[model samples]
Target: TKSQKIRAELLFKQFEDIKHVYYYSLELGKIFSTNYDKDVARAKLALWYNKIEEYGYDTFTTVANSIENHYERILNFFVNRSTNAAAEAFNAKIKAFRASFRGVVDMRFFLFRLAKVYA
Candidate 1:
C-alpha cells in the first residue's frame, strides 16, 4: 500500500496543472484540521479561496464560489467546530432505504417502516 501510494504521487507529479490543484486541496484539508479562532479561521479560508481562484481550476472555482456565497455560515464552524453528521447520515439511510425498495408506494406504510427501522 505504501508503494502504491508512492506510485500514485509520482503519477500525480507528471501533470503540472494537477499538482497545483492537489497542493491547494491539501492545504485546505490542513486548515480544516486545526482549531483556529474564528477570525483566524476566516482569514485562512479567505486565503485558501484566493489560492483556489489563482489556480483557476473550474471545479475548484465552483467550490470557492459556493464557499463565498455561504461565507458567514461557513465561519460558524469555528465557533464550536460542530457538524450535521447525524442528520446527514439519517438522510443517507432514508435515501438508501427508498432506493432498495425502488420507490415508496404507500406513504403511511413507508412512514411506519421508517419509524421502525430508523426512528
Candidate 2:
C-alpha cells in the first residue's frame, strides 16, 4: 500500500499534464453489469479525484491517441537520452584528469575531447 499511497500523493502533487482518470463503480446494473461491482471502483476513483480537486487543480482525460506510432516517436520523446548517457559515461572516465593535481591536460583541451565524444 506504500506504493499506492505514494501514487496517490503524487497524483495530488503532480496534477499537471496527466490526462484521463478512470474510476469504475460497482453497481447493480446502474453503470455496468448487474454481477460486476463497477460502482465500488468508481467510488474509489471519485475519492481520489475529490482529494486532488480540493487543491483547485484540474486535468483532462485522454485515451489512446496514436494508432500506428513507431520507434522514431520513442526517439523523439527522449531526444538526447542516448547521447547524454554516452557523454556522462565518457566524462566519468575522464574525471580524474580534471583534478587540479593532475593538470596533465588543459581544461579546455579535455572539454574539447569530451564535446567531440557527444558531437
lDDT of each: 0.89, 0.43
Worst 10 residues of 2 by lDDT: 60-69
Error of 1 at 113 (Å): 1.6
Residue range 50-89, candidate 2, lDDT tens digits: 4445533333211111211332442332333233567787
Question: Candidate 1 on 1-119: residue-level lDDT in tens?
Answer: 99988987897879877778878888888887899888999999999998888878998999899999999988888889987788899999999998989998998999999999975
Which residue pairs of candidate 1 clash? Answer: none
Misplaced by over 4 Å in model 1 are: 1-14
- The local lDDT score (0 to 100) that residue 92 gets in candidate 1 is 96
